[model samples]
Target: MARINVSQLKQACVDRGWLDRWLDDPATPVPMPMTPAGGIPVNGRLFHQLVAGLVQKLCVPDASAPLLALRSREQIWALLWDELAAAKVQALVRSQSAEAALHLAEALKAWCQRLAELRANCPNFKSWRSALLTHEFDLKRVAIQVSDGGVVEVSGRPDSVQVDPVHGIVVVDYKLSRGSNGTLDLLQLAIYARMLRLAKPGLNFAGLLEYYEPGLHLVPKTEAQLNAIFEHEVQPVLDRIAGHEKLMSKLKSVQVGHEAVRLSWQPKAEPDLGRDIEKAYNSFKVPVQVMGRVEAPQLVRYLIRPGLGISFAKLRSNAVNLKIQLGLHAEPLVMPGSGHVIFDVVKEKPDTVWWQDEVQRAELTAHASPLALALGVDINNRLILADLCDSNTAHALIGGSSGSGKSELLKSLVATLVKRNRPETLQLTLIDPKLLTFGGIVENAYLTGPILRDIEESLACLHLAVEDMERRYEILLAENHTRLGDRIAQGKTDLPFRVIIFDEFADLINSGREEKKEFERLTKRLSAKGRAAGVHLIIATQRPDKDVVTGQLKANLPMKICLRVTNAVNSQILLDEPGAEHLLGRGDFLSQTGSTPVRGQSLFIPQKEFLELFADKI
Candidate 1:
């Protein structure tokens, strides 16, 4: 058990993947830069004192001056200065004899101007004329029990609380700096709202960010949004803090350097690919020029400019010869286009992209849309995300042959989805016929049901998805909201996005005709209307054929991820054209979010690490 503040809890959850650090040292605050615009230095203490003095004089209710009512700029400044002097705020700012003192004066003047403009321009400010305001609201110690038989006594002091005509009890925090930290700011406000709700169960509490800007740039969040923030972003950190000993023990056993199958590798240098391409072209007398090249963890692409009057078809016809001359295991890929003929060659020693590194590097937050799926990194080292919220990428069809890392991709998808979102916001229905794909998975908080192995159970799971979609649609119609997100914003926090990850879809559909038809009907219905209802499907298979992936199914699943297929026919079956057959195996994949396909390396998380990371859930 430990005593902590809302700010400390927020810092612990700043990196959700590593909350154990907070248990080791609870007093240290997360560091933030204090520099203002134009490279001007700032004294943090002085700025806080000035802002506190201004807010006390202006926002708080006073018998002399009105509450949040606009006065002449000069009059307001005079009042604020008087209040600060009477309070004896700080000697540094009182002297006004140094650069820091000058900066504080400029800041105070800016605040006065912004306040004036806000009062005159914003309708909400006008409405707050009769609002009841409380400054420096204190939250006493509240003990919350954790799973590890420990209690955490949480406390905080929010800047202000206002009861307005429109929004009920609102917890407000003032931000005077130009820079913004979306994660920290939102967490602090949400924590305050939670504390207020706990104290006054009858009052509806919301969160607001009143920043220093012209015309009152206010960021208001509804009650449901705050609840979600507390559950997803705040509660998990508290749980980890309580159970840090067990988690740290598991983490200690994980040998991060164990490399039976290295999931992270970067080659020192790329093979002499440009020279090899020149030699290949010389043998064929095609007169092609190597314009440029781009290197990635999995593959290196060499951009070629054919000699004047050389057609793209001519270079495409020489792909086989080039592959043989360069001694490539996979076919040399010449993507379809009328522009310069780009050649993609697999690396001799391909790199294995690890999920742990990418997750930290991206600095992803749990507050992001639950449907945002991290689809590895591209050759340009950019994160490839497939937002299931969009129509085009609502449902996906993933195809690969043996040794194509199809199972690894599925594992990564499931792991990242659960890692980045809360169980209350995201739920998963895993249908693994192979069992080998998700065998390591156990009962977790994010699961909609147990890992289903039988075809009948899998179909039943899909049927439930269809039914859930219909029920949600009814809710939308009743609420007059077109999207699930809109309904949730209206305080319907119980609804979560349901994602169905079907491993070896071909096996499920290759059963009897009755089952196949039933599965098809359920999948097609869901795919057509799932995005609006917050339901998504990720169908993966090693068998890419007409039997498993039908025309109707392909039409609905526009987004496709194709790995190293057996032949061009299988590749064409997945991508609506050929090219995937030449993909470098072991996590190399091409995702077709739009018309064209882009190559990327899928992240690989070892089974041992995944189990260790989610041991509590299992």
Candidate 2:
């Protein structure tokens, strides 16, 4: 029998959808496939060596030893620098490449900086340092046989393992790569835990996946949990490999007559079938081989070569191009690094759930307690409810091109606010230059004044809002209160929450120099201090150019909702990121209230439904 390591096991699981097929039907026999012999990338090997060397030096300090106790931070830094320089020299000697050495040197500097930051911020730094010196640990390669006669052997070289009597054996593996932890890393840690448990049955074990880039990620897993994963996920796959079954069929390649082949796909009975197919094909920069077509309606299939599946990054790029060409919503379903892709044209818009839905109404009615605002359904089809006071009351900036569903989103937001609160509790100041966007809600009694359509009237309304904000602040100071919410809670004055909706803010800003400066001043003041006074602004614009959106305007508005835009530049201007350009239109948008952006599909409210909901009030 041959010896197998955790890497071999992981490769077997990933080769040609074998694991997915086995999980789908465990009784079905599958061939015992050999793991492909592929060389690890040069960068990967270097990262491994760097992590191992750092762990051996930094994580194994001995305080009781005279030489180790005399070491200061500067001395430790010098030692680390020397080790890194030696590693770089070794890499250059082996590869004869200066580029590789330079890369390694830069990585070492980054790792050193990260370590210093960790030392400064970690609360348990003292205890952690003490434990490093006192704990019994091993940092060497080990092999263990799982079954009798060595039918199954698993070998791994853990970065570090500390044997603590209180916390059992702690296995730590380092990941130098960026991004969130993946399944393979977790599985490798679990395998290490399993190997340790098998080698020393009396001792308990725990596993951790640690990263030393950007920040620290210390992920710990219990021995029982790891054992359970081994039993359910790892053991079954191993048993099947031992059984030896037939191999799964490979994907068939299509023969093309021309050097460049153009394939067309049409969804049956779909009105926009041709348009959708054109957009899908145009999305790819390089021509794709159309393997075959599926017989399902509204479905188009394309064969992706093995190990050549489109990644999310590539998909986002393609989506940006498609948005520019088609100017319509397109949702492509492709798993990162899969063997195939499907472009399904949505036949109709997603069904609209009424405000009268009992569950939805109940959720809305309960919003008074926390002052939460129901945004809409997210991309995952989950209801997105956010606290206005917490997430967006400071201010909001919205941007999208024409036909990108900005109007619909604004309408949905207003409807949500009105459905939940009475006129006495909430008031809206709506400004629509087009006059048609907010016409449906003009008759609502909650309006601070009838939706302002004239430019002068709109400007006056905004100025009044600024004055109102100042008055609220003075009231707070006089009452010895810090915030409006706090004043309201103490039963001071029942001033309704103010939400000023500015549709087509670009129109107002582009009106003249005077309007632009005045709007900028009032908006800056409101955005800076309005959240504490319970005043929020929701401003929308079709043009997101620098001159129109302006730096001063964006600096004030912290919460941004960006629908599909024309290009990456526009997307960056709107959200300070490039993802908004890749948004599928028709209210598919990215909401950025904090550092990370949340993707969601804005709720759609048909005019008929809107009229029905506000019939008596309007």
lDDT of 2: 0.60
Please give, for residues 285-307, the per-residue lDDT of candidate 2 as tens digits.
43344443433222233333222
What lDDT score is found at residue 541 in candidate 2?
Answer: 91
| Candidate 1 per-residue lDDT over residues 472-529, each given as its tens digit | 9998899888788666656666888788998898877888888888888888899989
Clashes of 1: 0
Candidate 1 Cα misplacement greater than 4 A, ranges: 1-265, 363-367, 489-491
Lowest summed lDDT over 10 consecutive residues: which window, candidate 1? 15-24
Local distance difference test, each candidate: 0.73, 0.60
